[model samples]
Target: MPSYFSLLFKQDFSDLKAAGNSWEKLSRKMHDAFDTHRTKVTGPLHANWEGDDAKNALRFLEDIETRVQIVQTEAMAITKVIDTTRHRMEQAQKDLRAVVNDAEAQHFRIDDDGNVRLPKQWEEPQPDESDETRHERQTKEALLQDYQVAINRAVDEALRASGEGQKALAELDGEILDHKNKQMAAESARDADKVMDQLGLKGPKVPDDPKAAAEWWKGLDADQQREYATLYPGRIGAADGLPSDVRDDANRLSMEQELNALQRGDAYAVPGNDDRLHNLQTLKAELDKRDGAPESKQLYLLNHDAGGDGKAVIAMGNPDTADNVAVQVPGTSTTMDSTGGQLTRIGKLQDAAENADSSASTSTVYWLGYDAPEAPLMEAANTDVAGPGRAEDGAQPLRDFTHGLRASHEGERANLTVMGHSYGSTTVGAAASGGEGLDADNIAVVGSPGMTVDRAGQLNTDNVYFGQAPDDGIGWAQGLSLGRGPTHPDWGGTRFETDTSGHSGYWDDGSQSLANQGRIIAGQQPEEYVPPGQHNG
Candidate 1:
């Protein structure tokens, strides 16, 4: 019998296949039962019940249904993991067998017992060696070289497969353990601990004030931090006072949970089915694109939601450790479906920021953590999304997000800048005008509909920056419903030259606007904005 490592190229995963198939079937059954319980049992009980006893009975049934759903979801996640492992095992075996088959086809004998012997003709030449005989001899030598190359490649792949096979098994073991733990948890008594103080929960207290929030986060020990991150990932991840690195980790887990639920066709993804699918595909494509970029960049998925009015915040590079961090808030018509394009734009800013100052590391964030107004070009003529309604609703989240960044940041406080484009400027301005103060070193707005305010002084930041293109139609919205565009002199900010690429072209590559924005984020002087002759104006 071969050892497990030696059999890595030949091992079968029939057991995993059977397990996965069983789980897949179980998931389907559970889903059907859950639906039936809702329609046939829960609905009727709720409609007919009036007394306390009936209400208590309904609650018990509902709790059991929730537990069943959790099991079904985990079963599906585990099934995917098992299927991946099975495929990897099959491919590894095929690769090894291909090398053996090729060698045998070339007349190099490979016995079942693993012995390789050259043809006897090489040991004893023909009695009278003719030209044809010599040619045959050379051909045999060439085949031998081919055999050696094939075997070498096969061995390299086999080694890799051996290591990866073990790794996959280890991961599967962890998943299995987690599944069991979840089951046990469902059966056990529920803990009454609230996960975060902000939500009025009992676990850990986080203050509303930015500075106090930082101190509250510092008070938690490693065990307590882990507990909160595990129990209430959504709250801990989105909480303003948590550490960025911790928030990133917690948020990633939360994002994965929500994504898995969505992929299973959960109810939350029902309202905007087409939009939800588009958003998921776009999010995956963007993550894949970033993974392919040169050099390793860490991605922090700070927030994600697939329900009505989607929100997402993706950050490239570790914001907690970086010397400079820039957060970009997109404007009108920016939905989760367009996240890939938004991430690319942020990537450009990240690259530009690095080029601006090689000595400092920069983290660029694409913030879509609020419901942006829908202003599709076809509906632009009559859309209310272009107004300040969405901005007013989004302002508080932006303020909290910014304050959280400040609270959780490490080392010497980083130089933070919040950049808003188009209607996003309105949202940022609203947040700034609320008087809580955004705890940022600078605030920049470009091609703005308005900031919901007239003066830069109201923004609570000394280094307020503004940019605009003369031809951009957003200039017309100034002093109207959207307030005043930041570029307006009365806004009382440093106005800089931008590209002629219309309202949305400010962050395009090789453009003066991007270079200027990069300089400001990199903590460079205002005089350093755009190199000589880079701008049209």
Candidate 2:
């Protein structure tokens, strides 16, 4: 996974610069503190402590030292660079920012292509001259002396009419803007996060009934997860609830975070910023705030993944292109934040497909807008997810994802390909057989436990593809099984039998699996499949 985050900001770079400076300062302070702490430890005070208390303090101090060392080790870890060569590069960037700021001040845009365009709002409009006006213009032309006559002759009525037409077209361009705005609004939630909160479709659950909290925790909803998190710090933390509430410290630091994120128009973590620490604070804040309030109006958070950062992160891809599109649904231990920002995994897969098919114009999207439940039987017995147990959890989410794709993009897509990894294969199988609004041309599975269908024809999809690595421990352990138990047999599609990449990260590198997937998208039936990440290519 790539570590650097490309935070989009306005032309000024105000937020970027602020975030950079704050990180640099904080890192320096921590470094200084570490040096001082080490010095103190070197003195007699370091060995003064005894028993369990001393051991705990020593462990804490050791962890802090490791962190400081790790930050110093990575090139981009610290916000500031201390190397000799990079200082000049940093200064150059600051200079470039200054120039870009000046360019923005003018009514012009230096686009990604380096071309300049007139600001949309400031462009001149077309004139509308009626017949009477034209006749009055002709009369004025007749009254023209030598100089006026020369001018009128030089600019003919045809030219005048053409100029007016262009001006009118320019004004009509506003209509194009209006139409596009409506279309975007239709696809995207206008104030999505607020809607999600209103629905109580956020975070872990916080049970309404404190008395039935334990049972409610069993079938915990995202809302009740939050309530439990509020009550968590005192309780050793509930299994199906948000973690402890660090309100006293987190609340105080949250103001700084908001100031940097909202005002600066970027997500910024405070002094003690780490993904987990920041997310803990965010969960508390989300739980504390009232649902449906205007404050939680981040559209992306609502429609996409809103569970800040949790233990697991899952990535599902819906591929749609000219030839054949494929959708990949994943199971448990998958959500946006749980994956340590790795949940943005869909983007790389999209890039891979597009890169492979320059002629086909393939596209990929991640649909994460519904709740899928596990089977009652599966839920009763404890089973490790990512195994046969995963098949059970992935059942409903895959179906929901497929339905979301069909409903959201009807005419915009074509030639579907559905592939489910782990439990997602079952979800795909279920969706293809019958669902609210899901359609697929082909289906495939990789690193899967079992898909519930007998054959591709039975599921009503055009084709079905299946893949399992020769060395995949899970595949070898539970091959071709679809029974009620975790090691159930013969549930996957028969068509595809590939292991282009062993188990994970097929698209990341030049692997056989990714290559074959790309070929499927290109609508070709030629050579063997080549996974992008598997090979050095």
Candidate 3:
């Protein structure tokens, strides 16, 4: 425990902060050095050199790289612990000074050791003393107790902060540098979380309103932002209003942690854990393939869940900076395992949109954030797809996500579009009709069963559009008491032509359906569909 006297007068946090900065600089330098080594030494050796000697040399270089990375990670952990302690101690010092100043202002004397003393008073009441004088003395004594309590509380807070800081510093053992690559990263994150818990700096309770959530994130200092993102990646990653890059970083860390845990066989108790593991691996592979790709092609992972049927939200480009943004919600049977294919589809959509208008940038997202109904072909009749319950439950989340996009976007507002396929159309419809709606400029549904609404006007958006292949069987679900699906002419929305066949072929490259979707996403009107009998030469 720290002494009250030291906390009140002698403690200085500048040196600690400086040390933290030094560690941070060292970590950055180490990272740069490692990158240089890989590019200049190992990369050439692996590409040009051969034989056992070359392999041995490469192995040695790889070990060196691993060791350097571990050192860098450990350095970051040290910086976090030091910076957190400095912040906490500085706050405690500020509190102590505040209470002491208030005590002095009120004519109460505070000693060097934090003891409060009343201003000079008569040792005893004299026989000639007036009643008012005695009462005044009594009042001063009572006030002295209050000042004392305040001083004691401030000192206790300082002591607690100091003790926790000490514990956190003690846990950053140098031996952590001896661990393997993945182990080092996971352990470092785990240790940071412990420090955060000890210092009472757990991740914030994010607000439901996307605007409020964005403001809340902006209010945190840089150190606190980094701590929260590193120590509680899962929570920060999933928070809607955070910046896309920040969310991407946090989610990547979370995915790495999940993969490490699953590899260690720690998730065996979870049902379908193997499937979860496979899905995560597939996602990682897909992301890795995009490394060093163009900025427009880079994938930003907004969120993910490996449990149950699994879920994920991925963006093909940075939505915050794009001129146009579209969120495409998948229908039934969508899960983490299907995320790779979904990413491919969104990429194609992005390309199509960009091709429509070369002057403006576009970002397309695969929003599998909701738990859509999943069932085998044999059990399709018993799935949640037959009911409006899942769509109703998912509507609020979908709305929140879109609002978050609105809150976090930079510069001019984006031309936002929300699209859904199959049952996902039901979710989009439900979201667009309820609450404040999906905050979208256009709502499009392909092969939609129903939108959980009777008309496009009910969706609160005038730019509603629908596309359904003639042979698609999913249209039968509209008769199952969902809503008046957009396929009907009386639905009061534009119907786009679909040149492809089957329920899933709408996204085939260069098809009329895909082209029309691209046009809608680019904020342009698609060519309206005319019934075969209605069209005349």
Candidate 4:
């Protein structure tokens, strides 16, 4: 345990931080070495060699690769433990200094021995002290005692941080590397979690507001931020108001962990585990395809879940730096399994926006952050399809997500457009009409049943637009369940033209419907719809 005097005056974490940095660098080098060994050595050897000796040698090389990976993983775990320890100790020091400074500010003195002493004037009593003077002295004495207690508590925290760090470091078995342990990754993750618990590094309580969440994120130091992102990825990844890249890293880690656990049968007892595993695997494969893609084409996993009706939110480009951003909400039957199709639609949307205006950058997002209604059949009799309950339930999450995008964006604010398809339009409508609304510049809905509002004006946005295919039956659902459909003339929103004829065909390649949405997303006015025989062009 660290003593109060040593913690206050003699403790330094610079060496610990330097060691962590070194380990991080070494971990990277080890990973690179493994990659090189596989590519340059084993890859060619397997292609050319054919003897039994070659087979044996290849097996040994594979073992070498596994061992190297284990070492790299262990190194990373060590770095995390060191960084977490440094952060905890530094925080403890900060608390100690604050209380000491506060005590001294009030004319009290703290000695090198960690004792708080009152001012000399308070030490001696006045010969003819009045009742008021005596009472003042007693209050001062109590305050001094409180300061001492605070100082002691801060010291105790430092001692615990040091002890826990020591234990966490000890638990990371170096023998795992020598043995080529296949389970080293899981062990390392468990060790990191233990450190988080022991050091109280679970991070601060985050508020639901995106702006406030961003503020809280910005308040943490680099090390603290790393610990929170690595150790508590589920929370950090789902938190709104964090940078897109930060969320991307955290979510990718969390998804990988969940996938690994499920594959290992560690979570076999979880309900819907098989479906959840399939969804995550499909999502991971899609993201893996864009591993080395361009920034504009890169996929950022903003959020994901393996729970009931698993959720996923992904961006086609870096939302934080894009000039134009569009958030597309999906309707019925969307889940983690729909990742590929939904991502393709957003990619096409991004491409359309860029084609409409090549000079400006655009990022299109597929927001399945809400639990859209799902049922066994697409019949109108299904309550999930005809009812507005799910849409209403998703309102606040959608609002928070859009607000988070706005809060985390850099430079000038992006021209944000929120578009919903099918039942998703109802969710968008519900979100925009309730609370502070989505704060979006434009709201567009395609094949919308209703926006949960009688009029577009109730959505709190002036640039509302609606598109409905000629043969889409979803329009008939308007006013039957949710509010009046946005396509209704009395709804008071712009009616955009759509060349496609079905509810799901609005995004068909080269169609006017897709072009019109691209125009709206690019901050331009879409062409107005006209009756079949009314056009003079």
lDDT of each candidate versus the true structure: 0.67, 0.39, 0.79, 0.82
Off by over 4 Å in 2: 1-302, 305-325, 337-345, 367-381, 384-397, 410-413, 434-437, 476-501, 526-537
Model 3 vs. true fold: TM: 0.81
What CA RMSD would candidate 1 show? 22.0
Ranking by lDDT: 4, 3, 1, 2
TM-score of the candidate numbered 1?
0.59
Evaluation by lDDT, superior candidate among 2 and 4: 4
Write the residue-wise lDDT of candidate 1 on 302-321 in tens digits.
77776555688888887877
| Best-matching candidate per TM-score | 3
The per-residue C-alpha lDDT of model 4 at residue 254 equals 68
Best lDDT goes to which candidate? 4
TM-score order of candidates, top first: 3, 4, 1, 2
Q: In terms of lDDT, which candidate is stronger, 1 or 2?
A: 1
lDDT of 3 by residue, 309-361 (tens): 77889998899999999999999888877877888889888887887888999
The TM-score of predicted model 2 comes to 0.37
Q: Candidate 4 on 1-537: residue-level lDDT in tens?
A: 754665555677789989999987776677567656755676667556788997898767756765565456567767877887788778878888888889889999888867899888998889899999999999999999998898888787777877877887787764554554443444555655665566565655777889999999999987567656665677899999999988987787667656656666663226677887888888876775555456698788899877777788999899999999999999988987788889889988998899888999999999998887886224777897788889989899999999999999999999999999999998999999999999999999999988889999999989999899889978678887788887777989999999998779999999999999999999999999896889938
How close to the true structure is residue 435 of candidate 4, measured as C-alpha lDDT?
94
TM-score of every candidate relative to the true structure = 0.59, 0.37, 0.81, 0.77
Candidate 2 overall lDDT versus native: 0.39
RMSD of each: 22.0, 23.5, 5.2, 7.5
Q: What ranges in model 1 sit over 4 Å off? A: 1-213, 266-281, 291-296, 376-383, 527-537
